[model samples]
Target: MLRLSRLTDYATAALGWMAERPERIVSVADIAQALHLEAATVAKVLRALVQAGVVESFRGATGGYRLSRPPAQINLVTIVEALEGPLGMTDCAAGAACEHALHCGVSAPWQRISAVVAATLSRMSLADLARPVAQRRHKEIA
Candidate 1:
């Protein structure tokens, strides 16, 4: 089955938490406590995200991490790429020149589907995930 790894899931959760309060600088410890995640893990994720330009890091008594850009300007594709490098359903489908790529029907279909999936993810900005859980559920129900 297709699924995001636990690290990616945690990254999304952490980022979503930060996105909720974009104006506030949040310490990794506080975010870890708030999300019931390990402080070290959150710290690592934060550092990587900062390096990828998704989050800006500040050093000081009152400094912490904040999104480098507005939620609307960052999409799932950006987040996924930041954490996982690139988006691809299959190795051969994502421009990898494999010996069997030209002859494999499965590769062609997966490539087409992967492109659609990438497009869908790229279209969903972080702002779309900033909605309250209740509101999101309401929309899901409708």
Candidate 2:
């Protein structure tokens, strides 16, 4: 089954939390407490996010993290690539020239699928994820 890593899930939750309060500079402890996750895990996730240019980090007494860009500009593909270093269902899909590349028939198809998946993810932004369930449902219905 296709699945994201636990860290990726936590990263999304943490990002969604920040997206919900984009104007607030939130400390790691605050995010952990709000999400009911371990502070260390949240810290790790935040570090990755900071490195990915997704979140800006500050230092000092009131220092905290905030999104580098508006939530609407941060898409799932960007987040996923930030954590996973690019989305690839298979080695061949990631542009790794396999030994069988010359004879492989599925390589092109897998690449196409990967492209579609990436495009779909690019369409989903953090702002969308932060929306209330009722609002999301209403949009879907409409």
Candidate 3:
């Protein structure tokens, strides 16, 4: 089955929360407490986010993290790539050294599928996810 890692899931949850209040600088501890996740895990995720240019890191007193850009500019593709490197449905699709890539008939199809998946993810932004699930469900119902 296709699945993202736990860290990627945590990344989405953490970024979604921060996106709700983009102006506020948040600590890992605060995010962990607010999201009911482990602080250590959140810290690692935030560090990766900072390196990915998704979040800005601050130092010294009152130091924390803040969104590097508006939530609308931060798409899921960027987030996924940040945590998981590249988005690849298959090893060959990700540019891995597959010995059979030259002769593999499925390589083209997998690459196409990967592109479609990436395009879909690129369309979704952190702002879209920042909304509370209940509100989104209510809107869907309406």
Best by lDDT: 3
Tell me the spans in candidate 3 whose CA falls farther than 4 Å from its real position.
132-142
lDDT order, best first, reads 3, 2, 1
Q: Candidate 3 versus the native: TM-score?
A: 0.92
Per-residue lDDT of 65 in model 2: 98
Query: Which candidate ranks first by TM-score, i.e. highest?
Result: 3
Q: What is the lDDT of residue 68 in candidate 2?
A: 94
Instruction: Report how far off residue 4 is in candidate 2 (Å).
Output: 0.9
Give one digit per residue, the lDDT tens place, for model 3 in 1-142.
Answer: 8999999999999998898789999998899999999999999999999999999999988999999999989999999999998888998888888988778899999999999999999999888877675377569999
Clashing pairs in 2: none
Tens-place lDDT per residue, model 1, 95-122, is 7779986577798788889899899998
TM-score of 2: 0.90
C-alpha lDDT of all candidate models, in order = 0.84, 0.90, 0.91
Higher-scoring candidate on TM-score, 1 or 2: 2
Q: Please, what are the lDDT tens digits per residue for candidate 2 over residues 1-142? A: 9888898999998998888778889999999998899999999999999999999999999999999999999999889888787788888998777999999899999999999999999999998877774376568999
Q: Roughly what TM-score does model 1 have, to 2 decimal places?
A: 0.87
Candidates sorted by TM-score, best first: 3, 2, 1
